[model samples]
Structures are given as C-alpha cells and as structure tokens.
Target: MEKKTYIQAFCTIENNKIVLNGETVFESENTGFADFSKKAYQHFEIGYPKFFKMDNLSKLAFLGSELLLKAQNPNDENNTALLFANKSSSLDTDVKYQNSISDKENYFPSPAVFVYTLANICLGEISIRHQLKSENSFFIFDAFNAAFMADYANILIETQKAKNVLCGWTEFFGEDYKAFLYLVGNEGAIENTKQNLEILYNK
Candidate 1:
C-alpha cells in the first residue's frame, strides 16, 4: 500500500503574530513585518545570524519554516523538497532595489538588497540553512493555491523523489505579510490534503 501523507507540523504568521500547531507562540505589537519577524526570531532564540541580513520576505519565510521544523527536523535533508508560493512575488524587494538605483544622485543599489529581488531567493536561503539539497520550486498566484501545493507535494512523495516536503505560502509586500508553512510526512494527525491545507491556512 502507498504511504499516506500527513501534516507533521504547521505554522502561521500574520497580524504580527506567530502560531505553531494552532498555538500562539509569538505575538508583537510591532506594526511592520520586519519588526514583528525580528521579535519572533529573538523570542524563539534562533541563533542564525544570517537571518538578520535577509530581506523582509526572506525573514518571513525563514521564520515560518523555522517554527514548523523545530520539532520535526529532517534526517535526510537530501530527500526533502521545498515547495513555496506567494502572490506578490518579490515586489517588495524590487521596489527597494529600484529606489536605490532610480535616483542618479543616490545610484546605490546595494547588492544585499538586489540579491533578494527574486521570490526564489527565500527558498535558497531556507535550503542553505537546512542543508536541503533536493527538489525545490516557487510559484506566484493571485491567492494561495492550496490545491496545487498539496497535490504537487504528494506527487513528490509518491514518486519517491522526496521523502519529506516542506511547503507553504509566504507573501510579503510592505507592512502587510503572511506566511503559512507545513511539513508533510508519512505520519501525523492531519492528512495532507487540499482541504486541510486551506483550513489550516485560513485558521
């Protein structure tokens, strides 16, 4: 029999709050995504110094995955897959980079800022942190396409291309941002399905 996929763990970040497995772990009054993410990182005692250098979008994605994978760290990083999606893509960083070069007077496009102008950069950051060297992809949509993510992750697992799948929707634009990440494995409380993903994402 084919192994059944389950949601091993999940995390949600929005409204300056971080929720892990339906439990509120971190909340801050900070109005901006940058501040809120920093607070959560400090609260969690995440020691990765590189996190401080990431842009707002990468910070959001990193924190969300960090919380979700806290307890369920993968043993086989090579067989783990990362599937992520968002609505805004990299508009937030694009604007910042554009502004840096737009002014001839300034003419200062920081490489640090330019590096994160692509939405997939967050995936690269996460993979580097986790040492995950497996299949990875990023998608952009008008809204969270829970069905596609669920089905695609299952396909990875079913084909034996990946033993585990870390997937989510992380959207960041200015002060408005949200990240919902979940780990799919062969055992857990909730089955990995589109409906369950949508429900968890909504919750």
Candidate 2:
C-alpha cells in the first residue's frame, strides 16, 4: 500500500496580510512591501538578522516559510526538501542589480544584491534558517503549477528521499507580490493532492 501524504501546514503572504492555514495571523497597514515585510518580521519576533539582508523575494518566501515551519521545527530530521516556484523569477532583484550598474559613471554593484538573482536563493534562506540539507528544487512557470508541485512533492515522499517537503509559490516583482508555502508529509488533516493544493493556494 502507498503511504498517504498530507499538507501539514500552509501559509500565504500578500496584500500586507499574512495568512496561515486559512487564518489571517498578521495584517499590516503599511502600503509598501519593504515596510510591510519588515513589520511582519518584527511581529513574528524572528531573531534572524540575516533576514533584513535578503532581497525582497527572499524576504517574502522566508516569512511564509517561517510561519509554516515555526512550531514544527523539522530541522531535527534534517530531511525536509524545499520546493518553490515563482512567475517573476527574481526579476525584482534583477532590476535592482541592473540599476546598480546601469550607469557606468556611477557604477556600484553590491554583492549582497547580486547573490539573490536566482529564485532559488529564497530556498537557501529557508534552508539556512531551518538547517535543512535535503534535496531541493525551484521552478519558474507562468503561474502556480499546482499539479506539478503536488506530484513532485509526493515523489520525494514516496521515494523516502525526504521525511517531508516544504513547497509552494513565492512571487514578488515590484510592488506586486504573493507567497504561498505548504508542508507535505505523511501526517496531516489535508491530503496532498493537486486539487487540495490549489484550494489552499487560492485560500
């Protein structure tokens, strides 16, 4: 018999609001992503100073991951694979890095900004924070690929390559941004299916 996989927890961050498991855990009045994200970080009381250094995309993904993985602390297993996707694919930071060198006369490029050019860096941030060292993957699609995400996560679980998979979509480009993160494992109230994934994502 095949083992059952479920969505242990899920989180979403967008519209200056942070939603976890269909509940609004945090909402900010700030209008800008930067300010709103920072305030959200402070509200969570996350002591990781490195969060402030990450690009906007990383910050967005990191926050959503933090909420989903908070009390679970799956770091003990060290086998939680990360799977993330985004439509913008780090364009927000690419634009920033591009502007730094756009003017040859005032050319100044910060390595900090350059490092997060890839969407996968957001996964790195989550891994570093949780001390996760399992196999991870990131994808770029026109929109949230719920079917692919569900199938991919289940493959990892069924293969026993990972005890659990932390996966979702983290999209941020300019002021437009949205992050939806979910944890997939052998135990939970919700089954890990494309329909359920889309339902949680749309929530």
Candidate 3:
C-alpha cells in the first residue's frame, strides 16, 4: 500500500501564540511553561477556569487535540498520533512535585505530578481528551526534521493501518516552548516542501 499524505496543521507557542493553517491565531508574551499552558488554552477558546485547573501534561495535550480535531474529517476513525522532539520534559510540574515532597515534613508523592514526568504523557492526555483510540507514538528529536517526519507519516499510511496521521514537533525548553502539529491524511491540504515547513516555522 502507498503512504498517505498531509492535510492541515496547527502550531502554537508560549503566550497565547498560535499558527493555524499557517496563520497566527493568537500572539502574546512568552513566559514560563505553566503560564504558557494557561495562555494556550485561551487561544483554543477553552477559558481560564478550565485551563488553570488542568494538569501540565493535560493542558499541552488538550491544546494539541483541539487543533487536530478542528481540522479533521468528521467521519474519519482511522487516525494516529505521532509526536516528536525535545525538552523541559514536564520540568514545571516536576519542580512542584519535588517541592511538595521536600516542603512537607510528612513528604507525599503526588500521583498527578508523577504522571507528567514522561513526555509521552502529553500525547496520552490528548488521546483522552479527544477519545482518540488510534495508534500513537512519541519521539524526541534535537530539532524538527521534516524528512524524518514525512517518512514516519508515510510508513503509517502506507501500511494500510492508518488513514490519517497527526504528526509534529512539540518541545518545551524551560521558558520556551513550541508546538507544531499537522493532520496528515490520505486526502487533504498539502505542504509538500521542507522550505515551506521552515518558512512557516521562521514566520
């Protein structure tokens, strides 16, 4: 079987910043991871209350889930999620988790804090949010490699396993974070070049 192709993508960063269909949805001051999570939810129109209460990984996942679903085909069920690349790795929540243990005389490990330790938890959080029961995988890359991403998406689609593959780079490094997601489908919008991807990222 031949591999499927890409349809649409939604990217966002710290401070209510967003890039939907290669366009900006919201732009604001970039800050620490927690604050970024709050601002990101607002961009998705999920309001502050609901946003603030969500766990760190949950927040990241929810934002990614919302973007992909918005661009999805209503009847599509053969979906897959493939998230790739880099840091902070729940550092914000980890700090809190460690603090909770040290600050208290009794010392208790927070289940919530422990959950966000793995980077893939973000993907799981998204899956739970969207009820996405398809295949999912996460990878860490030093930087966005368009070729590798394209190849991975192609493999999933060509296997006759998945009709759509949500692929991208989502990394959080301390005070900086970036999320770039593409809803890859057999039939949909196309961004067929590396230059194009780089161009979008640069802008």
Candidate 4:
C-alpha cells in the first residue's frame, strides 16, 4: 500500500501574465477569450473547432474544458462540472447583444450573442464539447471560497454523483480576463485541492 500523490491544479491571470498549467503564455494587452483562444491554439497545437470564434462564452468554455479534460482521469465517466465566480456575467456579449436590440433600423436579437447572457452557459458549452453529462452547477461569489469548493467536490465524489470533478473560476473583466480550473478526483494523480485554489487567487 502506498500513499498517493494527487495533483490538484489551477490556472490564473496575473500581472499581465496568463498562467496555464503553471506556465506563463501571454502578457498584457487586455487579454480575453480571444487571447486565451489564440494562446491555447498555439500551446495545444490543436486548432479550435469551427464555431469557437462565433461566441465569446463558447470560447471561454472551450478553453476551460480543454484544460480540465487534460487533467481528467481518462478512465472515469462520472465527472461533474462546478464553476464559481463573479462580475459582468457575460457583459461582453451583453454589450454586443444590446446593439442588436437598440438599433431600431434593424432591431434583431443576435442569437449568438444572446446565448451567452447567463454566466452558466459557459458550463453548458464545456459540457457539450466534452460530452460530459454528470452533475453541474454554477455559483457567483465576490472571491474564491476554498472551503465551499472543497466541500462541494468531496460531496459529489462521496455521494457517487461523480468520481471526478472539474471546478473553476472563469471571468472576463471587459478586455481583461482570468480563469482558474482544477480536476478533483479520488484518483491518485491530483493534488492540493482547496489549498491550490487559494494560491491561484491569493497570488
């Protein structure tokens, strides 16, 4: 019998740096989903699917899923998505969507932009992209809550709602953006859990 080493992880934005898998890929320039997508495309070598550029939240969701899927246990199917965050709640798209309604000359809701008004849509996009149907939830908070995140994840696993969980905070502050994600599971490969999440935001 051996004590297992779990690798609980997170990605974040800081000092104009985009931290992903603990590596800084881009800097400054008001990075958002577009920047995230470009950097992700460069880093992963897999081009984004055809429709990513069509929507802001979809792009963010795609990026989050890409990171979480890499950390997921390939053998596990019972996985849940838990997201936490605050601010704007897709204000980026809301602004764009408003124009469609505001213009009396051709007032029409852009379904593309309208689809992202709810912050939780990001989760749906990710789930669909990954074919993940396990339990999923979204929470809005002023800051990251280590205790709540840990408890929720543990509950999901202990109750058999899922064997693994993808928990995260994804946000866009106008042109600026930040995202932190983790894969939590009973499997022996993830580490740090709540402590790792603290390091991400507290940094």
Model 1, runs deviating above 4 Å: 1-3
Candidates in order: C-alpha RMSD to true structure: 1.6, 1.5, 3.2, 3.9
TM-score of 2: 0.95
Which candidate do you rate higher for TM-score, 1 or 4?
A: 1
Model 2 per-residue lDDT tens digits across residues 1-203: 26779998888888999988888999989679999998998999998999989999999988988887785854534888998998999899999899999999999999888999888998888888988888898999999999999889989989988989989799998899989998898888999998998888887
Which clashing pairs does model 1 show?
none
Give me the runs in candidate 4 sitting further than 4 Å from their true place: 1-7, 13-17, 25-36, 187-196
Tell me, by TM-score, which candidate is best.
2
Cα lDDT of all candidates, in order?
Answer: 0.88, 0.89, 0.65, 0.64
**Inter-residue clash pairs, candidate 4:** 6-190, 6-191, 7-189, 7-190, 7-191, 8-190, 8-191
Give the range where candidate 4 is weakest over 10 consecutive residues by summed lDDT: 1-10
Query: 1-203 in candidate 3: lDDT tens per residue?
Result: 24447546656554456667766776667466676666666556764364455556556556766776766766774466554555456666677778878866879897856877677776676666666787787776668777677777777777856777776677664455667766776765665346555665566
**TM-scores of all predicted structures:** 0.95, 0.95, 0.79, 0.79
State model 1's lDDT: 0.88
- Name the better of 2 and 3 by lDDT: 2
Model 1 lDDT, residue 110, Cα: 88
Compose the digit string of candidate 1's lDDT tens values, residues 9-62. 899999988889999988899667767777788899999999999998899999
Ranking by lDDT: 2, 1, 3, 4
